[model samples]
Target: MNRKPADTEPVTNAPEWTVSSLSGALKRTLEDAFGHVRLRGEVTGYRGPHSSGHAYFGLKDEGARIDAVIWKGVFQKLRIRPEEGMEVIAVGRVTTFPASSRYQIVIESLEPAGVGALMAILEERRRKLAAEGLFDESRKRPLPFLPEVIGVVTSPTGAVIRDILHRLADRFPRRVLVWPVRVQGETSAAEVAAAIRGFNALPRAMNGPTGPVPRPDVLIVARGGGSLEDLWSFNEEVVVRAAAESAIPLVSAIGHETDWTLIDLAADLRAPTPTAAAEKVVPVRLDLLAAIADLARRHRGAMMRLGERRASDLRALTRALPSADNLLAGARQRLDLAGGRLVHMLGAGVRRHEARLAAAGQKLARLSPLVLLERARARWATAAQGLGRGFAHGIERRAAILTRAVSRLSLQPLRLRAEAGRERLTIAGTRLANARAARLAAERARVDNLWKLVESLSHKGVLARGYAIVLDSEGHTVRTRAAVSEGMALELVFADGKVGATAQGEGAQPATRGRKRKSDAAAPPPVQPTLFGGGE
Candidate 1:
């Protein structure tokens, strides 16, 4: 304890260290010792990017742990950012923070430790989206039975588009709208999502450069088979969400049958390949035509069966009905018996009326006017003396009446009255004749107007427009080409007259009656390409 000045041997010369200098020296030594490390450890203590966009986290294994830092510039360039509890491989320089005198790894790059890490991230995302009900069966819609226009989201030059086009052409040709996009890489998810929304943004029907740009009734998001990382674009949340929210029914054909992606869950239907998606979108044209023909045959057979049944019933009813002669026999017999009794009944009625008339005449004779005349004569005799004066007064009154009649009577006045009556009769006759003539003229005009209306409304007026009515031998309309056959009798009624003709053959094409226009020979519309460009 007392050997400080002379007892100890002379100490070797050494430089003094300040705290900062010492810390700096240690930092340099750590950096020099482990210039860069490819450390594999589980990421911990990562909340997120700091305010300055730097990331500070810890890398820990079961045996040990170290502080790790990703600077703002390096973090921005990282493809995979550090997540808490994510096992990652970090390549970085090891140095000490002089202020705290602590050593940390300054990471330059970071990636998942292995495929297992990527799977972990994928499963976590799947669970999150599933919890939000994005992958529910109820949310999935049915693919259109036949999409007139099919929208495809895929690479423009890939075999997938060609296969889909070929398959669709083989089954049922449909107009295809291609939205070319990158199938993989950093920007794949965004491009694919934008393609889906862009398709949805198109009008249901609109005119484009060549023709109509009809919105797809159904969509196909497709790509050839590839590894999980290659197909990871479809599994991205943005892609999955776009598929889930699409109004158009979506079919996902991302990979081979064994391969699947998040889009497969979100899509309305999933196909093993692009060709299979084409098959699901439309039915075979030939098969549809065959089915329609079969239905037509069935309908005709049903109608014929019904007609035959109705005819048989009618025959049976006709046989059960009585003849007209049989029904009228009893009525005829009753009418003959009544006719025989009519004369006797009329004679009996006449005899009863004659007896009633004779009784009335006998009563009238019993109350005759001779009895009243005799009584009147006896009364007149008793009043004869008083009547002498009355008789004289009557003679005087008759003489005065004769004198007045002679004074009033005049032939000239009578003749004038008769002439006036004749004039009035003549005017009345003229007026009656005029009224009759006007009535007759109005009736004749009405009849003429009605006849003109009938002529205008007749079917002959339609024939006057250079059209002909074709009638079969049985006077039925031969409306369709199928109804005509070789040696079939036909009647063509034109404006002036009708002509009878025979059909030449089944394959004969009806000649065009009128002159053909130049536009009738114009070329057909151009075909649209199956794939569009602009893919990366």
Candidate 2:
């Protein structure tokens, strides 16, 4: 079925198109492919409008991107200048130029993609430079407090140079040698580096020509605000190294307050702007003059005070001369008096020491244990002799007394008395035996009677006589019938046995009532027994 339709149609082989025709179609296709396209990307290598009033740069994303162009007519309408690495949304028409046969977007309008992209780029660049020791504190040089001459490197035709010049004039008005250099574009980094080296290499005299001819004690690199790409010359490694290696102290002033460049870190000091760099490098003329005047006044005041102090010191010294002489004479007299008193005291002390030494020697001799022992031995010998004589005398007297006593106590009488005493002792011993036997028999009878009394008083004897003691559960004897009710269980205790019994039908009540009735009758009153078994 398809072959039948092909036969019905006419076909011929021919040349397709001309080069121009193909190119035209290609251009149209390319235009249609990207025409009126909206692109979001960061701007890199951004060059602002040139004399031709055209901006050229690349628009890039994370993966890929393309080149872009904007004529001055459209660029001038932009509220904010586009900077490198600044993400932007660009609305433009795509076109392919016939000359180069290249495709690009001709931007009509643009706005920031977002602020985050700029911050990210800043942070990334900071990290990269920081890792390379470009921002190391050790690399920074110290600026001279009062530089003899400041070398300025900046655009010869820009507000940056004029601002710097005016500020220097207003401040120290010192001679500043200008190193005219391009502060932007391709050759900017090279020009700035050359300017730094030139200043550093100049001799003191050649730096300037008259009136304290300028010697570059310091160098200032200055620039005005622009896009990141415009200010990129300051961030170039060459410019950074030049500033770091400069023999003269360098100050970096690039862009606005928020702009940071690698050269700023490498320089001795970083100023917010070109005008600030000039102000930082020199002191104000009026302020310095005032400071000098104040110093002079202080010096004069100090000199006056010093002169007054010297004069007062001289007067005091003149007055003190006579007093010093009097003090010397009085000191001599006091020394003489002190010497006499010391001699008298020494003489008295010598006598007192000698007496004390003699007393100490005498006490030492008295306290000697040998002397005391010798005296004690002599006393002991005398006491022994006295004791012997007393003992001999006492023995003689005792002998006489003993002899008289013996004579008084005759053996015949003593023997008779001893025999009589023996006979009496024999008789007494016989009587004592008889009395002991009778006492023992009497004690046995009293023991038997005590046993019988104890048996009669024993609880067992009472039980044997058909009497039972009732005790409560606590083992205390119940003395009265009222102590336990009719239904209360009671423990009856004998001498050797006990039984629990409940009071039934009040069996003891009649006995209690009969006793009460008998007590109520006018019978002879029953005597109560005391604890000692005495009738009361």
Candidate whose lDDT is highest = 1
lDDT of each structure? 0.80, 0.74
Q: Give the TM-score of candidate 2.
A: 0.40
Itemize residue pairs with steric clashes in candidate 1: none
Write model 2 residue lDDT over 215-330, tens digit each, in one string: 68888888889887677678766787788778888898999999888788888899998888998998888998899999999999999999999999999989877766776998
Candidate achieving the largest TM-score: 1
lDDT of 1 by residue, 1-536 (tens): 65576757777779999998899889888889999889999999999999999998899999999999999988866657688899999999999988877888999989888889988988888999999999999998888788888999999999999999999999999999899999977678889999999999898778989987889899999999998878878888889999999999999998899998989998999999888998999999999999999999999999999999999999999999999999999999999999889878768866865675576556545433333334434554455545546555654665466446545767466446545644664565566557656755664464445445545655677888788998765454566675666676789989999999988965545443223223322323222111111111
Error of 2 at 514 (Å): 99
Report the Cα lDDT for residue 305, model 1. Answer: 100
Residue 177, model 1: lDDT of: 89
lDDT computed for candidate 2: 0.74
Candidate 1 weakest lDDT stretch, 10 residues: 527-536
lDDT (0-100) at residue 293 of candidate 2? 100
Show where candidate 1 strays beyond 4 Å: 1-12, 16-35, 51-54, 70-81, 205-212, 306-536
Compute each candidate's TM-score over C-alphas: 0.54, 0.40
